[model samples]
Target: MTLTFIQNIGGGFLIIMLLFSLIYFLLWVYCVIDVIRSNFKDQNMKLIWIVILLFAHIIGPLVYLVLGKNTKVGY
Candidate 1:
């Protein structure tokens, strides 16, 4: 009964969270792949960014996108 009421009323919240989670995972994977495929002036940057993404889950990708993306040197 309670579950049904919550589902009826608050189901939008669950859907929104699910969507956000999917988008977030995609962003993380994209960033990780970009880091691998990119070359930086600093060779260790790739390893460091991968470690950051591996351990820093939430903040790592955002930081990489904002700060590190521009640091790529070559194709």
Candidate 2:
């Protein structure tokens, strides 16, 4: 009985992990695309942002969006 209960909990945890992974991947993609499409004052800035996003994983994108991106909504 205890074994079955433990298995059920493990299955649920696995499903949750998969879901989180999917979300993380999608967010990463969106951040990369945004950095590519965005206009910056310096021509090389976009390249730098892309490199950061690619190598730094989740934290990279979050930091860029929060600190680096321009607040103007039009672009």
Candidate 3:
């Protein structure tokens, strides 16, 4: 009985870890795509932010999304 309980617990932990990893990976992909699609007047600025996001991990991407430049309309 104890052995079966241990196995069940271990399996549950592994499943949770797998799900978390998939969510993280999807978030990373979305961040990259959103940065690419955003309308920053300066291409350099966009590229710079993308690179920072890719190399800096989760926090880096979040920072760029919140603070990066958006499109500027000139009249």
Candidate 4:
């Protein structure tokens, strides 16, 4: 009985892990696409952002969401 309970718990954990991984992948893809389509005068800047998003993994998207915007506004 105890073994069966343990197996069930492990299966639940695996499902949770898979779900989290799918979410992570989706978030990463979203970041990549946004970066590619973003308006930046300098093409090099776009490339740099793409590299950062690809190499920085989880932190990349969070960083982009926080700091990857044009701060200027109309006068």
Q: Which candidate is the best by TM-score?
A: 1
Q: Name model 1 segments beyond 4 Å from true.
A: 1-9
Candidate 2: C-alpha RMSD after superposition = 4.9
The lowest-lDDT stretch of 10 consecutive residues in candidate 2 is: 66-75
Model 4 superposed RMSD (Cα): 5.2
Write the residue-wise lDDT of candidate 4 on 1-75 in tens digits. 988876778777989989999998898898788877777766677888889998999799888777777521211
- Model 1 lDDT per residue over 12-52, tens place: 78889899999999999999999998899889989999999
lDDT per residue for candidate 3 within 1-75, as digits (tens), equals: 988876778777988989988987887788788777776676677788778887888687567656664432231
User: How big is the positional error of residue 16 in model 2, measured in Å on the Cα after superposition?
Assistant: 0.8
Residue 33 displacement in candidate 4 (angstroms): 0.5
Runs with alpha carbons beyond 4 Å of true place in candidate 4: 1-9, 71-75
Q: Sorted on lDDT, highest at the top, how do the candidates line up?
A: 1, 2, 4, 3
Which candidate, 1 or 4, has the higher TM-score?
Answer: 1
Clash pairs (backbone) in predicted model 2: none
Residue 43 in model 4: shift from native, Å? 3.1
Q: For each candidate, what is the lDDT?
A: 0.89, 0.79, 0.72, 0.78
Poorest 10 consecutive residues of model 3 by lDDT? 66-75
> Candidate 2: deviation at residue 19, Å?
0.7
Report the lDDT of model 2 for residue 23.
90
Worst lDDT 10-window in candidate 4: 66-75
